[model samples]
Target: MDKKLKRKVLTASLVGSSIEWFDFFLYGTVAGLVLDELYFPSSDPIVALMLAYLSFSLTFFIRPLGGIIFSHIGDRIGRKKTLVITLSLMGGGTVLIGLLPTYAQIGVAAPILLIILRLIQGLGLGGEWGGSLLLAVEYAPKGKKGLFGSIPQMGVPIGLVLGTFTLTMMSLLPHEAFMTWGWRIPFILSALLVVFGLWIRAGINETRNLKKRKNPGRLPNYRLLIH
Candidate 1:
Protein backbone atom coordinates (compact mmCIF):
# COMPACT_ATOMS: atom_id res chain seq x y z
CA MET A 1 0.00 0.00 0.00
CA ASP A 2 1.10 3.56 -0.62
CA LYS A 3 2.46 5.32 2.46
CA LYS A 4 -0.11 8.12 2.47
CA LEU A 5 -2.99 5.75 1.75
CA LYS A 6 -1.93 3.39 4.50
CA ARG A 7 -1.91 6.24 6.97
CA LYS A 8 -5.29 7.37 5.79
CA VAL A 9 -6.70 3.90 6.23
CA LEU A 10 -5.12 3.71 9.65
CA THR A 11 -6.75 6.95 10.67
CA ALA A 12 -10.11 5.69 9.52
CA SER A 13 -9.60 2.41 11.30
CA LEU A 14 -8.81 4.18 14.53
CA VAL A 15 -11.34 7.01 14.39
CA GLY A 16 -14.13 4.95 12.91
CA SER A 17 -13.86 2.36 15.65
CA SER A 18 -13.92 5.09 18.26
CA ILE A 19 -17.02 6.64 16.78
CA GLU A 20 -18.79 3.34 16.19
CA TRP A 21 -18.17 2.29 19.75
CA PHE A 22 -19.28 5.65 21.03
CA ASP A 23 -22.63 5.03 19.41
CA PHE A 24 -22.79 1.45 20.63
CA PHE A 25 -21.93 2.19 24.24
CA LEU A 26 -24.49 4.93 24.31
CA TYR A 27 -27.15 2.27 23.93
CA GLY A 28 -25.55 0.18 26.64
CA THR A 29 -25.70 3.06 29.11
CA VAL A 30 -29.37 3.60 28.43
CA ALA A 31 -30.21 -0.06 28.01
CA GLY A 32 -31.65 -0.93 31.39
CA LEU A 33 -33.01 2.44 32.43
CA VAL A 34 -34.90 3.54 29.36
CA LEU A 35 -35.69 0.18 27.86
CA ASP A 36 -37.58 -0.90 30.95
CA GLU A 37 -39.99 1.98 30.67
CA LEU A 38 -40.29 1.95 26.90
CA TYR A 39 -40.44 -1.74 26.25
CA PHE A 40 -41.86 -3.32 29.38
CA PRO A 41 -44.24 -0.76 30.81
CA SER A 42 -46.84 -3.36 31.68
CA SER A 43 -44.37 -5.14 33.95
CA ASP A 44 -43.31 -4.12 37.42
CA PRO A 45 -40.04 -2.28 37.86
CA ILE A 46 -38.26 -5.41 38.97
CA VAL A 47 -39.39 -7.44 36.03
CA ALA A 48 -38.82 -4.61 33.61
CA LEU A 49 -35.34 -4.00 34.91
CA MET A 50 -34.57 -7.69 34.82
CA LEU A 51 -35.74 -7.99 31.25
CA ALA A 52 -33.91 -4.85 30.25
CA TYR A 53 -30.75 -6.14 31.84
CA LEU A 54 -31.19 -9.39 30.02
CA SER A 55 -31.31 -7.49 26.78
CA PHE A 56 -28.26 -5.53 27.82
CA SER A 57 -26.30 -8.64 28.70
CA LEU A 58 -27.40 -10.22 25.50
CA THR A 59 -25.65 -7.52 23.49
CA PHE A 60 -22.27 -8.27 25.02
CA PHE A 61 -22.71 -12.00 24.91
CA ILE A 62 -23.69 -11.86 21.29
CA ARG A 63 -20.58 -9.84 20.52
CA PRO A 64 -18.57 -12.99 20.04
CA LEU A 65 -20.93 -14.01 17.31
CA GLY A 66 -20.38 -10.73 15.52
CA GLY A 67 -16.65 -11.13 15.93
CA ILE A 68 -16.76 -14.52 14.29
CA ILE A 69 -18.87 -13.41 11.38
CA PHE A 70 -16.90 -10.27 10.79
CA SER A 71 -13.61 -12.06 11.19
CA HIS A 72 -14.52 -14.55 8.53
CA ILE A 73 -15.62 -11.85 6.20
CA GLY A 74 -12.65 -9.69 6.98
CA ASP A 75 -10.17 -12.51 6.58
CA ARG A 76 -11.87 -13.74 3.46
CA ILE A 77 -13.30 -10.75 1.67
CA GLY A 78 -11.75 -7.60 3.10
CA ARG A 79 -11.83 -5.44 6.18
CA LYS A 80 -13.68 -2.57 4.52
CA LYS A 81 -16.83 -4.55 3.69
CA THR A 82 -17.00 -6.17 7.08
CA LEU A 83 -16.77 -2.86 8.88
CA VAL A 84 -19.43 -1.37 6.63
CA ILE A 85 -21.77 -4.26 7.37
CA THR A 86 -21.11 -4.02 11.09
CA LEU A 87 -21.80 -0.32 11.16
CA SER A 88 -24.98 -0.83 9.22
CA LEU A 89 -26.17 -3.49 11.63
CA MET A 90 -25.46 -1.40 14.69
CA GLY A 91 -26.81 1.83 13.20
CA GLY A 92 -29.98 0.17 12.03
CA GLY A 93 -30.57 -1.35 15.45
CA THR A 94 -29.98 1.96 17.19
CA VAL A 95 -32.27 3.89 14.89
CA LEU A 96 -35.00 1.28 15.17
CA ILE A 97 -34.93 1.45 18.94
CA GLY A 98 -35.53 5.19 18.77
CA LEU A 99 -38.57 4.55 16.63
CA LEU A 100 -39.99 1.75 18.74
CA PRO A 101 -43.32 2.32 20.47
CA THR A 102 -43.68 2.04 24.21
CA TYR A 103 -45.73 -0.70 25.83
CA ALA A 104 -48.44 1.86 26.41
CA GLN A 105 -48.67 2.17 22.69
CA ILE A 106 -48.09 -1.42 21.62
CA GLY A 107 -48.65 -3.58 24.69
CA VAL A 108 -46.42 -6.70 24.96
CA ALA A 109 -45.13 -6.18 21.47
CA ALA A 110 -42.99 -3.28 22.59
CA PRO A 111 -40.63 -5.37 24.62
CA ILE A 112 -40.64 -8.03 21.97
CA LEU A 113 -39.54 -5.54 19.35
CA LEU A 114 -36.91 -4.15 21.66
CA ILE A 115 -35.50 -7.64 22.19
CA ILE A 116 -35.19 -8.21 18.47
CA LEU A 117 -33.41 -4.92 18.01
CA ARG A 118 -31.14 -5.85 20.87
CA LEU A 119 -30.32 -9.06 19.05
CA ILE A 120 -29.32 -7.05 15.99
CA GLN A 121 -27.18 -4.87 18.23
CA GLY A 122 -25.52 -7.87 19.83
CA LEU A 123 -24.79 -9.40 16.46
CA GLY A 124 -23.44 -6.15 15.01
CA LEU A 125 -21.32 -5.24 18.00
CA GLY A 126 -19.92 -8.72 18.18
CA GLY A 127 -18.46 -8.11 14.73
CA GLU A 128 -17.42 -4.48 15.21
CA TRP A 129 -14.65 -4.39 17.82
CA GLY A 130 -12.57 -7.22 16.46
CA GLY A 131 -12.60 -6.05 12.85
CA SER A 132 -11.95 -2.44 13.76
CA LEU A 133 -8.82 -3.46 15.62
CA LEU A 134 -7.77 -5.83 12.89
CA LEU A 135 -8.11 -3.10 10.31
CA ALA A 136 -5.82 -0.83 12.28
CA VAL A 137 -3.38 -3.57 13.15
CA GLU A 138 -3.00 -4.77 9.60
CA TYR A 139 -2.37 -1.30 8.27
CA ALA A 140 0.26 -0.42 10.85
CA PRO A 141 3.85 0.12 9.75
CA LYS A 142 6.52 -2.48 10.40
CA GLY A 143 6.82 -3.30 14.11
CA LYS A 144 4.01 -0.88 14.93
CA LYS A 145 1.10 -3.32 14.92
CA GLY A 146 0.90 -3.32 18.68
CA LEU A 147 0.64 0.45 18.86
CA PHE A 148 -1.93 0.72 16.12
CA GLY A 149 -4.06 -1.95 17.75
CA SER A 150 -3.93 -0.08 21.02
CA ILE A 151 -5.04 3.15 19.38
CA PRO A 152 -8.26 1.61 18.16
CA GLN A 153 -8.75 -0.01 21.54
CA MET A 154 -8.78 3.42 23.12
CA GLY A 155 -12.12 3.97 21.42
CA VAL A 156 -13.64 1.48 23.84
CA PRO A 157 -12.99 3.41 27.03
CA ILE A 158 -13.55 6.72 25.34
CA GLY A 159 -16.89 5.51 24.09
CA LEU A 160 -17.84 3.97 27.42
CA VAL A 161 -16.95 7.13 29.31
CA LEU A 162 -18.78 9.36 26.89
CA GLY A 163 -21.75 7.08 27.08
CA THR A 164 -21.71 7.25 30.86
CA PHE A 165 -21.60 11.01 30.79
CA THR A 166 -24.40 11.26 28.28
CA LEU A 167 -26.59 9.00 30.33
CA THR A 168 -25.75 10.83 33.51
CA MET A 169 -26.80 14.10 31.96
CA MET A 170 -29.99 12.58 30.67
CA SER A 171 -30.69 11.23 34.13
CA LEU A 172 -30.74 14.79 35.42
CA LEU A 173 -33.88 15.60 33.52
CA PRO A 174 -37.26 15.19 35.20
CA HIS A 175 -38.37 11.59 35.43
CA GLU A 176 -41.52 12.06 33.39
CA ALA A 177 -39.88 13.79 30.43
CA PHE A 178 -36.80 11.69 30.68
CA MET A 179 -38.79 8.54 30.53
CA THR A 180 -41.28 9.75 28.00
CA TRP A 181 -39.08 11.58 25.52
CA GLY A 182 -35.59 12.41 26.74
CA TRP A 183 -34.55 8.80 26.31
CA ARG A 184 -34.91 9.26 22.60
CA ILE A 185 -32.15 11.83 22.42
CA PRO A 186 -29.31 9.36 22.55
CA PHE A 187 -30.91 7.00 20.09
CA ILE A 188 -31.79 9.81 17.75
CA LEU A 189 -28.29 11.20 18.02
CA SER A 190 -26.98 7.96 16.53
CA ALA A 191 -27.79 9.40 13.12
CA LEU A 192 -24.95 11.85 13.39
CA LEU A 193 -22.70 9.14 14.77
CA VAL A 194 -23.47 6.74 11.95
CA VAL A 195 -22.87 9.44 9.42
CA PHE A 196 -19.58 10.26 11.10
CA GLY A 197 -18.52 6.63 11.22
CA LEU A 198 -19.27 6.37 7.53
CA TRP A 199 -17.40 9.52 6.64
CA ILE A 200 -14.35 8.21 8.40
CA ARG A 201 -14.63 4.88 6.66
CA ALA A 202 -15.59 6.29 3.29
CA GLY A 203 -13.32 5.86 0.24
CA ILE A 204 -10.58 4.31 2.32
CA ASN A 205 -8.40 1.51 1.05
CA GLU A 206 -8.84 -2.02 2.28
CA THR A 207 -6.34 -3.47 4.74
CA ARG A 208 -3.12 -4.57 3.04
CA ASN A 209 -3.18 -8.05 4.49
CA LEU A 210 -6.74 -8.68 3.36
CA LYS A 211 -6.02 -7.31 -0.08
CA LYS A 212 -3.03 -9.58 -0.54
CA ARG A 213 -4.72 -12.79 0.49
CA LYS A 214 -6.94 -14.83 -1.79
CA ASN A 215 -10.33 -15.89 -0.51
CA PRO A 216 -10.06 -18.48 2.27
CA GLY A 217 -13.30 -20.10 1.07
CA ARG A 218 -14.31 -21.34 4.50
CA LEU A 219 -15.97 -20.21 7.70
CA PRO A 220 -13.68 -18.89 10.39
CA ASN A 221 -12.53 -21.38 13.03
CA TYR A 222 -14.06 -19.24 15.73
CA ARG A 223 -15.26 -21.93 18.09
CA LEU A 224 -13.90 -21.85 21.63
CA LEU A 225 -10.40 -23.25 21.68
CA ILE A 226 -10.34 -25.06 25.00
CA HIS A 227 -7.45 -27.47 25.21
Candidate 2:
Protein backbone atom coordinates (compact mmCIF):
# COMPACT_ATOMS: atom_id res chain seq x y z
CA MET A 1 0.00 0.00 0.00
CA ASP A 2 1.12 3.50 -0.76
CA LYS A 3 2.08 5.69 2.21
CA LYS A 4 -0.58 8.25 1.42
CA LEU A 5 -3.30 5.66 1.17
CA LYS A 6 -2.27 4.06 4.45
CA ARG A 7 -2.51 7.42 6.19
CA LYS A 8 -5.94 8.07 4.71
CA VAL A 9 -7.26 4.70 5.83
CA LEU A 10 -5.84 5.15 9.32
CA THR A 11 -7.34 8.61 9.65
CA ALA A 12 -10.69 7.39 8.45
CA SER A 13 -10.69 4.54 10.89
CA LEU A 14 -9.64 6.68 13.80
CA VAL A 15 -12.10 9.45 13.12
CA GLY A 16 -15.01 7.16 12.47
CA SER A 17 -14.32 5.03 15.52
CA SER A 18 -13.93 8.08 17.71
CA ILE A 19 -17.26 9.50 16.59
CA GLU A 20 -19.09 6.22 17.14
CA TRP A 21 -17.67 5.87 20.63
CA PHE A 22 -18.44 9.48 21.45
CA ASP A 23 -22.05 8.73 20.66
CA PHE A 24 -21.84 5.57 22.76
CA PHE A 25 -20.25 7.17 25.84
CA LEU A 26 -22.57 10.15 25.63
CA TYR A 27 -25.41 7.84 26.55
CA GLY A 28 -23.63 6.61 29.69
CA THR A 29 -22.92 10.13 30.81
CA VAL A 30 -26.48 11.18 30.16
CA ALA A 31 -27.94 8.16 31.88
CA GLY A 32 -26.54 9.15 35.27
CA LEU A 33 -26.91 12.86 34.70
CA VAL A 34 -30.05 13.34 32.70
CA LEU A 35 -31.95 10.12 31.99
CA ASP A 36 -33.08 9.67 35.59
CA GLU A 37 -34.77 13.03 35.47
CA LEU A 38 -36.47 12.44 32.15
CA TYR A 39 -36.90 8.91 30.84
CA PHE A 40 -36.89 7.00 34.16
CA PRO A 41 -38.32 9.51 36.58
CA SER A 42 -39.67 8.02 39.82
CA SER A 43 -40.83 9.40 43.13
CA ASP A 44 -37.71 8.02 44.72
CA PRO A 45 -34.57 9.55 43.22
CA ILE A 46 -32.56 6.43 44.01
CA VAL A 47 -34.93 4.24 42.01
CA ALA A 48 -34.87 6.58 39.06
CA LEU A 49 -31.08 6.63 38.99
CA MET A 50 -30.98 2.88 39.34
CA LEU A 51 -33.36 2.47 36.43
CA ALA A 52 -31.24 4.83 34.34
CA TYR A 53 -28.11 2.83 35.16
CA LEU A 54 -29.92 -0.39 34.28
CA SER A 55 -30.80 0.97 30.86
CA PHE A 56 -27.20 1.98 30.32
CA SER A 57 -25.96 -1.45 31.35
CA LEU A 58 -28.37 -3.21 28.99
CA THR A 59 -26.49 -1.76 26.03
CA PHE A 60 -23.35 -3.56 27.16
CA PHE A 61 -25.16 -6.88 27.11
CA ILE A 62 -26.59 -6.32 23.62
CA ARG A 63 -23.21 -5.26 22.22
CA PRO A 64 -21.91 -8.78 21.76
CA LEU A 65 -25.01 -9.83 19.86
CA GLY A 66 -24.49 -6.81 17.63
CA GLY A 67 -20.92 -7.91 17.06
CA ILE A 68 -22.06 -11.35 15.95
CA ILE A 69 -24.62 -10.00 13.52
CA PHE A 70 -22.43 -7.28 11.99
CA SER A 71 -19.36 -9.52 11.89
CA HIS A 72 -21.43 -11.81 9.75
CA ILE A 73 -22.30 -8.91 7.49
CA GLY A 74 -18.65 -7.88 7.31
CA ASP A 75 -17.64 -11.39 6.37
CA ARG A 76 -20.33 -11.73 3.71
CA ILE A 77 -20.31 -8.24 2.25
CA GLY A 78 -17.05 -6.50 3.25
CA ARG A 79 -15.62 -4.54 6.17
CA LYS A 80 -16.09 -1.13 4.60
CA LYS A 81 -19.74 -1.80 3.93
CA THR A 82 -20.27 -3.18 7.41
CA LEU A 83 -18.64 -0.15 8.98
CA VAL A 84 -20.96 2.11 7.01
CA ILE A 85 -24.00 0.18 8.17
CA THR A 86 -22.90 0.23 11.80
CA LEU A 87 -22.04 3.89 11.72
CA SER A 88 -25.41 4.79 10.22
CA LEU A 89 -27.31 2.62 12.68
CA MET A 90 -25.46 4.19 15.64
CA GLY A 91 -26.02 7.71 14.42
CA GLY A 92 -29.68 7.08 13.72
CA GLY A 93 -30.20 5.71 17.22
CA THR A 94 -28.51 8.65 18.84
CA VAL A 95 -30.57 11.15 16.89
CA LEU A 96 -33.81 9.36 17.68
CA ILE A 97 -32.89 9.28 21.38
CA GLY A 98 -32.52 13.03 21.31
CA LEU A 99 -36.00 13.32 19.90
CA LEU A 100 -37.64 10.84 22.29
CA PRO A 101 -40.43 11.96 24.61
CA THR A 102 -39.87 12.07 28.34
CA TYR A 103 -41.72 9.83 30.81
CA ALA A 104 -43.99 12.67 31.72
CA GLN A 105 -45.22 12.75 28.19
CA ILE A 106 -45.49 9.05 27.31
CA GLY A 107 -45.59 7.21 30.68
CA VAL A 108 -43.98 3.74 30.60
CA ALA A 109 -43.33 3.87 26.88
CA ALA A 110 -40.56 6.42 27.34
CA PRO A 111 -38.22 4.08 29.25
CA ILE A 112 -39.13 1.17 26.99
CA LEU A 113 -38.23 3.11 23.85
CA LEU A 114 -35.02 4.39 25.45
CA ILE A 115 -33.88 0.83 26.06
CA ILE A 116 -34.57 -0.08 22.43
CA LEU A 117 -32.49 2.82 21.16
CA ARG A 118 -29.69 1.90 23.55
CA LEU A 119 -29.72 -1.59 22.06
CA ILE A 120 -29.42 -0.16 18.57
CA GLN A 121 -26.53 2.00 19.70
CA GLY A 122 -24.83 -0.99 21.31
CA LEU A 123 -25.27 -3.09 18.22
CA GLY A 124 -23.66 -0.48 16.04
CA LEU A 125 -20.72 -0.09 18.39
CA GLY A 126 -20.20 -3.84 18.84
CA GLY A 127 -19.41 -4.04 15.14
CA GLU A 128 -17.61 -0.73 14.93
CA TRP A 129 -14.49 -1.35 17.11
CA GLY A 130 -13.35 -4.42 15.25
CA GLY A 131 -14.11 -3.00 11.83
CA SER A 132 -12.24 0.19 12.63
CA LEU A 133 -9.18 -1.73 13.76
CA LEU A 134 -9.26 -3.83 10.62
CA LEU A 135 -9.59 -0.76 8.44
CA ALA A 136 -6.46 0.66 10.01
CA VAL A 137 -4.24 -2.43 10.29
CA GLU A 138 -5.18 -4.07 6.99
CA TYR A 139 -4.01 -1.00 5.12
CA ALA A 140 -0.62 -0.89 6.81
CA PRO A 141 2.52 -1.52 4.77
CA LYS A 142 4.85 -4.18 6.13
CA GLY A 143 6.41 -3.30 9.53
CA LYS A 144 3.99 -0.47 10.26
CA LYS A 145 1.09 -2.76 11.16
CA GLY A 146 1.33 -2.36 14.95
CA LEU A 147 1.51 1.39 14.74
CA PHE A 148 -1.48 1.55 12.48
CA GLY A 149 -3.44 -0.86 14.68
CA SER A 150 -2.92 1.35 17.71
CA ILE A 151 -4.45 4.32 15.97
CA PRO A 152 -7.92 2.93 16.38
CA GLN A 153 -7.22 2.32 20.05
CA MET A 154 -6.65 6.02 20.48
CA GLY A 155 -10.29 6.46 19.64
CA VAL A 156 -11.41 5.43 23.13
CA PRO A 157 -9.74 8.31 24.91
CA ILE A 158 -10.46 10.67 22.09
CA GLY A 159 -14.11 9.69 22.23
CA LEU A 160 -14.19 10.07 25.99
CA VAL A 161 -12.71 13.52 25.71
CA LEU A 162 -15.14 14.53 22.99
CA GLY A 163 -18.16 13.25 24.89
CA THR A 164 -17.08 14.80 28.16
CA PHE A 165 -16.20 18.11 26.53
CA THR A 166 -19.42 18.38 24.61
CA LEU A 167 -21.47 17.64 27.70
CA THR A 168 -19.43 20.10 29.70
CA MET A 169 -20.16 22.84 27.22
CA MET A 170 -23.80 21.93 27.10
CA SER A 171 -23.92 21.91 30.87
CA LEU A 172 -23.16 25.59 30.89
CA LEU A 173 -26.79 26.15 30.01
CA PRO A 174 -29.06 26.92 32.96
CA HIS A 175 -29.99 23.80 34.93
CA GLU A 176 -33.57 23.69 33.73
CA ALA A 177 -32.63 24.25 30.10
CA PHE A 178 -29.85 21.69 30.34
CA MET A 179 -32.24 19.14 31.72
CA THR A 180 -35.13 20.01 29.42
CA TRP A 181 -33.47 20.33 25.99
CA GLY A 182 -29.73 20.90 26.26
CA TRP A 183 -28.78 17.27 26.75
CA ARG A 184 -30.42 16.29 23.47
CA ILE A 185 -28.15 18.63 21.50
CA PRO A 186 -25.18 16.25 21.66
CA PHE A 187 -27.25 13.27 20.56
CA ILE A 188 -28.84 15.15 17.67
CA LEU A 189 -25.49 16.64 16.68
CA SER A 190 -24.13 13.12 16.22
CA ALA A 191 -25.86 13.09 12.84
CA LEU A 192 -23.33 15.58 11.50
CA LEU A 193 -20.44 13.46 12.76
CA VAL A 194 -22.01 10.41 11.11
CA VAL A 195 -22.23 12.25 7.78
CA PHE A 196 -18.54 13.07 7.95
CA GLY A 197 -17.57 9.51 9.00
CA LEU A 198 -19.57 7.93 6.18
CA TRP A 199 -18.04 10.26 3.60
CA ILE A 200 -14.50 9.41 4.73
CA ARG A 201 -15.20 5.68 4.91
CA ALA A 202 -16.88 5.73 1.49
CA GLY A 203 -13.57 6.69 -0.08
CA ILE A 204 -11.79 3.68 1.46
CA ASN A 205 -11.13 0.83 -0.91
CA GLU A 206 -11.78 -2.72 0.25
CA THR A 207 -8.73 -4.27 1.88
CA ARG A 208 -6.58 -6.23 -0.51
CA ASN A 209 -6.32 -9.12 1.97
CA LEU A 210 -10.04 -9.82 1.62
CA LYS A 211 -9.84 -9.56 -2.13
CA LYS A 212 -7.03 -12.15 -2.19
CA ARG A 213 -9.06 -14.72 -0.27
CA LYS A 214 -10.03 -17.62 -2.54
CA ASN A 215 -12.70 -19.02 -0.24
CA PRO A 216 -15.46 -16.55 0.61
CA GLY A 217 -17.49 -19.59 1.66
CA ARG A 218 -15.54 -19.75 4.93
CA LEU A 219 -17.19 -16.53 6.13
CA PRO A 220 -20.05 -18.26 7.91
CA ASN A 221 -17.57 -20.11 10.12
CA TYR A 222 -15.98 -16.80 10.97
CA ARG A 223 -19.36 -15.45 12.07
CA LEU A 224 -19.95 -18.54 14.20
CA LEU A 225 -16.65 -18.12 16.01
CA ILE A 226 -17.77 -14.61 16.88
CA HIS A 227 -20.81 -16.10 18.55
The candidate that achieves the highest lDDT relative to the unseen native structure: 2
Worst 10 residues of 2 by lDDT: 218-227
Give the true-structure RMSD of model 2: 2.8
lDDT of 1 by residue, 1-227 (tens): 57777677767766667666776777766767777767765437888777777877777778888788788877677778888888888888888888888888988888788888888877777778887777777777777777777877877887777677777888889999888888777777777877777877887877655555575658763331110
TM-score of each: 0.88, 0.93
Candidate RMSDs in Å, in order, are: 3.6, 2.8
Model 2 clash number = 0
